[model samples]
Target: MTDAGVIDDYVTGLRRVLRGPRGPKIDLVAEARDSLLDAAEALEHGGLDRAGAERAAVEGFGSIGEVAPDYQETLSVPAGRRPAALLFVSVPLTTLLWSLIWRVFPTGPAAHAAWPGWFVPVARGLDILQMLVGVIGGVALLVLGRGLRRIRRPGTG
Candidate 1:
């Protein structure tokens, strides 16, 4: 099919998806149209064949809904925050629960509880640190994703 024809088909598919009421429906048709137009312009100047240009356009634009499921799972706009939040909540909670259990359990009546009791605090602190690191890493990922999106935006060099 012609490049224009292929682009139209892609747009139609995206529109059909968006028209549905399930999940995070987005205006993928508009996004594909813009991407195709940009790619078509480049191909026109670069002397690429219709098929080649269309393929490039579609591939470069990527699948609109490909990242949607991840986003939903993470409860993140771009899909990185969910894991971060999960880690942030889980680590501390798990550490505290484990610490309490460990501290309460006795290895032996003669065993000194004071020295061993410190281990629980140390483990809990490590858990908190792990959570902090995860949060920072997640934020960095989210920020990088945003930067990439900006770079891909129309009119950007």
Candidate 2:
């Protein structure tokens, strides 16, 4: 293949592996193209012809499968944050839902006493479940968000 064809294929393979906004992807492609051309120019200076220089550049850079994962890791958001953000959003929403349910059903002492036996048990069960969810979600949000923050902090991994 021609020099341009080889570079195009490399960029195309990279684009296939990367997952993000178009702006980042385009930037990555441009950077990769520039790097490949630079490497090719270096090889040409070392006495290889244009086609040989391009081929050597691509080979030295490694195949798309080999290099794309490193780029993907750098470009993509860390997976842990997704669950943390979800928990942050969900905890309050769940609490609000339970609050709305209680408001609609009136789950106070008098209401509980007047309600059917099955109703009290079911309501109590739901309350327990809601509390558990809220506690677990809150803890997860704290832990995950804290961990992410630490990872992002300056001079730290």
Cα lDDT tens digits, model 1, 91-152, are: 77767876686676545656545446576677677777767867777666765466435423
**How far in Å is the alpha carbon of 112 misplaced in model 2?**
4.4
Q: What stretches of model 2 exceed 4 Å from their correct place?
A: 1-3, 18-27, 45-47, 75-83, 99-106, 112-157
* Candidate 2 lDDT for residue 32: 92
What is residue 37's positional error in candidate 2, in angstroms? 2.4
Off by over 4 Å in 1: 1-3, 19-28, 64-157
Residues 107-128 of candidate 2 have per-residue lDDT tens digits of 6667767666676676677678
TM-scores for every candidate against the unseen true structure: 0.34, 0.53
lDDT of each: 0.59, 0.70
